[model samples]
Target: MLKDRRILITGGAGFIGSNLAEYLKESNDLVVLDDFSLGKKENLSGLDVEIISASILDDSALNSIEDVDVVFHLAAVPGVQDSIERPLETSMTNFIGTVKILEMMRKKDIPSIIFASSCAVYGNTEKVPVDESTCPEPLSPYASQKLASENMIKNYREIYGIKGISARFFNVYGPKQDPNSEYSAVIPKFIRRCIEEKSPVIYGDGKQTRDFVYVKDLVRALSLIAEKLPDEHVFNIGSGVETSINELAETIINETGCGKEPEYREKRAGEVERSLADIGHIKGLGWKPEYSLKDGIKETIEWMRRSR
Candidate 1:
C-alpha cells in the first residue's frame, strides 16, 4: 500500500476510481476530483477521502490540489458509441482534458501519473493478442482521443520530465458499475439482467471477444504502478485470457440460474469486434490478475444482489 503520500484521482467517484480509492485511502491522503456527471456520490459512501466536485477541465479544481505525490488520470468521456455520437464533446474531455491535467502536473511539479487508457486504442487488430509493440489503429473518436492523450503524456514526460505511464485497460467490470447507465459495460448489465430474470442484450453476433480484467485486479495494477514507478511508460492491464460475449453471458446466466437467452441486436457503431490484451508488460512488474471470469462474475453478482 502507498503510505504517507498524497494522491489525486480525477474520476474517483465512479466504479473503478472508487474501488481504487478504497484500496489506497487507508494508507494515503487521497483526494477525488470529479464533476459527478457520470460518477455517483453514493459510490464513495463510507470512504474516508476528500472529494472535489469538479471536472478535470476546471482549472480552479486542478490548481486547488497541491503537494500530490501521484495523479491517477481516470476522468474521461467514456464509451465508443457515446463518443461516436458526440465526437466534439468527447475530444474536449478525453483529449483536451488530458492536456489540462498534464499542464497542471507540469505547474505543480508532480513527478508521476498513471493514466487509465483503454484497449479500444488497439482497434480491429489481426494479431491475436495486442502487446505494447503493436501499432495502434484507433477505430473511434474515443480511442483516437485516448491515443492522443498517450502521446501527449509521452511528450510531457520526454520534454518536462514528468513520469507518465499509460495503462491500456481491457473490459473492466465489477461492483459499483451502474447497469442502469446507457454506456455501462456488458458484465454488470448482464449480471443485473440475470438477477432480474431478464435476457441480457448482445450487440453484434455475440462472438466478439474481450479480455475481462476484474476491477480489484485492475486497481492492484494501478497501485503497483504508483508504488514501483516502472521504467516502461505503457502497460496492458488485463486478465490476458480471452472470452467471447456468448461465453461471458453463459457464465452469468449459470451463476444466477436465470436461463433467459441473450437477445441479439444490431451492432453498435465504433465498437471493436475482438479485444485481448498481452499483459506481459505489467506482469513483469510482479502483477497479475487474481480473479478468473467465473470468480469475478460471482463476486459481481453478489454485489449486485445486495445493492439492487
Candidate 2:
C-alpha cells in the first residue's frame, strides 16, 4: 500500500521500529529519527534508509519533516517498572515528546499518524482481555504517559485536523529485542538466560499472564493502520492469547534445549497481575497474528543464538 509514499518513523533503531522500517523500506520512502539512547544502530545496520540521529525531546530535531505522508510515533521510554523508578524522565519523553511531534506534524501538514501505545494503561483490571474501550487505570508513570499521549493525539485530531490512530500494543517480543538492557522485556531476557544455561528469574509466582505479540505481526498492523487511515481510531494489537511467565519460561527452555529451571523471586512493585488484548478491532481490519507463541519463541531463539 505504501508505494513510494514518504514515511517517517521515530525509534526506528529499536526492536519493533527496526522491523517496521524493514517492512516499509522495500516499497516506501523511509526516514528514521532516533536518539540512540535505548535503540542500537546495529539493529538498523543493513537497512537502506535515511537515519536521523536526534532526540524527540528536542522540538527542532523533530521539526525537520519534509513531505511526510505518515508519522509512526514509536519512540518513548518503554517499560512499566522503569517508569516507576524514573517518572519525570518517562513523562518528559513519552507525553511531552509526543506533543512536540504532533505540533511539528501539524505544521508540516502530515496526513496521518499511527501512535504506538501500550496495554499497561489498563493496569491490573478484572477484565481478562482488555480492549480499546476499557477505561485506563494506569499503574505506573509509563502507562500514564502513554495514555496521555493517546489523549493528545485525539485532541489534536479534533482541534488541529490531524488524523491519527492509537494502537495499544500488548507484550511485544521477537528478534533484535535488546536482552542486555536493564528494561528488557520478559521474553528476550528469559531466552538469553536460557541460551547461557542460566536459570531464568521470574518475579512473584510466575503465574501473571500477558499477551505476547511477535514483532512481525505488529509491523503488519502498523502498516495496515497507515494504509487504512481510520478516522481518529484505536485498536489493540496482540496474539489474543494469554501466557504466564512460568509457561513462557517453559516454552523458551523447551525451544532452546536449555536444561535449567526458572527461579522465582519477590514480585516487583507496580506489576500487573495479568494482561491480554481483545484484538477483534484489528482483526476486523483483515490483520491477524500469524506467529503463535511457540513459533515466535523458536524464531527468537534462533535469532538470539545467531547474535551470540
Candidate 3:
C-alpha cells in the first residue's frame, strides 16, 4: 500500500520509529526527522532515506518536508519517571511539539497522520482492558501531555478536515530499544542488567502488570493505519496480554540464561498498577499482533546479548 508514496516519520531513529522506517523504506519514499537526543542515529544506519538531523520542537524541521502523504508522528519524551523529573521538557516536546506538527500539516495541507499515542493516558483505570471509549485520566505529566496531544490531533481533524488516526500503543519492546539509557523501558533495562551479570532492579513488588507489544507488530499496525486512514479514528495497538513485572523478569532471566534475580526497590510515584488494551477497533480493521510476550522477549534478549 505504501509503494511510491512520500512519507515523513518524526523520531524515525528511535526504536519504534526506526522499525517503521526500515519496513516502509523498501516501498515508500522516506524522510526521517530526528535530533538524535534520545533516538540514536545508529538505529537508521543502514536505511536508505533522507535523514534530517533536527528536532520536532524546531519549526524549520517541520517546514523542510513538503508534499508528504503520511506523517507518522512518534516524536516525544517517553516515560513516566522521566516525565516526573522533567515535566516542563516533557510537556514542551510531547504537547507543544505535536501542536507544531499539526500547524505545519495544516499549512501544507497534509492529507493524513498516524499519531503514536500511549496507554498511559488511561492512567489507573477501573477498566482492565482500555479501549478508545475509556475516559482518559492521565496520572503523570507524561501521560497528560500525550493525552493533550491526542486532543490536539482530534481538534485539527475536526476543524481543519485533516484526516488522522491515533494509535494508543501499549508497552512496546524489541531490538534497538536503548538499553544503556537510564530512561530505558523495563524489559530492556532488565535484560541489560542480566546480561552484565548485575542484579536487575524492580520497583515495588514487581506486581505491576503491563501489555508488552513487539516493535515489529507496532510497525505493522502503523503501516496499516497509514495505508487505510479511517476518518478521525483511534485504535488501541496491543497484544491484549498482560504480564506482571515479576513474570517479565523471570521470563527474561530464563531466556538470557543468566539465572539472576531482580533486586527489589520502592515503587516510584505515579506508576500505573496495571495496563492492557482492548484492541477490538484495530482488529475490526483486519489487523492483529503476531508476537507473543515470550517470543518477543526471546528476540529482545538475543539482541541484547549480541549488542554486548
What's the CA error at residue 35 for candidate 1, in Å? 0.4
Candidate with more favorable, higher lDDT: 2 or 3: 2
* lDDT accuracy of residue 73 in candidate 2: 94
Q: TM-scores, in order shown?
A: 0.97, 0.97, 0.96
- Model 1 misses residue 135 by how many Å? 0.3
| RMSD list, candidates in order | 1.2, 1.2, 1.4
Q: What is the lDDT of candidate 1?
A: 0.92
lDDT of each: 0.92, 0.90, 0.88
TM-score of 2: 0.97
lDDT of 2 by residue, 171-272 (tens): 899999999998888899999899989999999999999899999989998998889887637899999999999999999989989999899899987677
Pairs of residues clashing in candidate 1: none
Worst 10 residues of 2 by lDDT: 57-66
**Taking the tens digit of each residue's C-alpha lDDT, what string does model 1 give over 1-308?**
57789999999999999999999988899999999999999999999999999989999988898899999999998988899899999999999999999999999999999999998888899887899999999988999999999999999999999999999998999999999999988898888888889999999999989999999999999999989988889999989999999999999999999979999999877467778899888999999899999999999999999997
Q: What is the lDDT of residue 225 in candidate 2?
A: 85
Q: What 10-residue stretch in candidate 1 is worst by lDDT?
A: 267-276
